[model samples]
Target: MLFPIFLLASVAAAATGVIFKPGAWYDGLRKPGFTPPKWAFPVAWTIIYLLSAAAATRVAGLPGAGAALALWAAQIALNTLWTPVFFGARRMALGMAIITTLLVTVAAMTVSFWSLDRVAGAMLLPYLAWLCVASGLNWRIWRDNPAVPRPAA
Candidate 1:
């Protein structure tokens, strides 16, 4: 039950990607040599999100889970914000900022979860690894697409 609840929340966040797709703006970018194939993003992210939700659920009832779960919530919110910032709004710098925070939150969550449940911590490893990849991608895109305008904040 706990896992399902957390998974549902993650799915809702993941849904944002569907709404704010990488359309023509992304298509025209001079992607790095390491840019993943078009089909890979969704595939990788789906697995990562599910694992992250399950990891959070596993530790949600632990004695010291509050901070961990709060970090979970924060990271997911940042996760949801990325697609809109990067793809929908085309603000790569802001997206990078969001994801940078997300990366830190996720690393903290991984450590926090490890203290409570090793298995749960292990579940998040791929997600952490993937975030590293994503951060690199975001940074590369920001660097390569210098002409892209960021909205005035």
Candidate 2:
């Protein structure tokens, strides 16, 4: 019951990537040398989404789950916002800010979930690791691309 709902929410958040897309703007950015290959993005995100849903499902009905679930919702909302800000609006700095906030929120959520269910908290470890990579990538892009090309009027 709860798994489907959580999965649906995760899928909806993931949908932002499809809608905004990297397209040419992202391709033109001065990516860090360590940037993951283009194919890795979707694959990694797929796994993250599945893990996030599972983690949420594991903790949803447990005692004292409210604050942790709130963090989950907040992180997902931030996740949904980052795609459009970075890909659609081409704002690297703002994207970095949002991702940083997401990282903190997820970390807090992980610790909270850990208190309720260790496995659920453990499931979020990969997500936290991925977010660190993503945050570094965003920071590098923002630092490297100072004079970003403005979208054509």
Which number leads on lDDT?
2
Which stretch of 10 consecutive residues in model 1 shows the poorest summed lDDT? Answer: 144-153
- Candidate 1 differs from the real structure by a C-alpha RMSD in angstroms, to one decimal, of 1.7
Q: How many backbone clashes does candidate 2 have?
A: 0
- Cα lDDT tens digits, model 1, 1-153, are 798888888898889988987887788888899888989988998899888888887898889899999989998899988989898888888889999999999999999999899999999999899899999999999998999765466
TM-score of 1: 0.94
List model 2 lDDT by residue over 1-153, tens digit each.
899998998899999999998888788888988999999999999999999999999999998999999999999999999998888888888899999999999999999999999999999999999999999999998999999875664
Flag regions of model 1 displaced more than 4 Å.
149-153
Q: After superposition, how far is residue 93 of candidate 2 from its true place, in Å?
A: 1.1
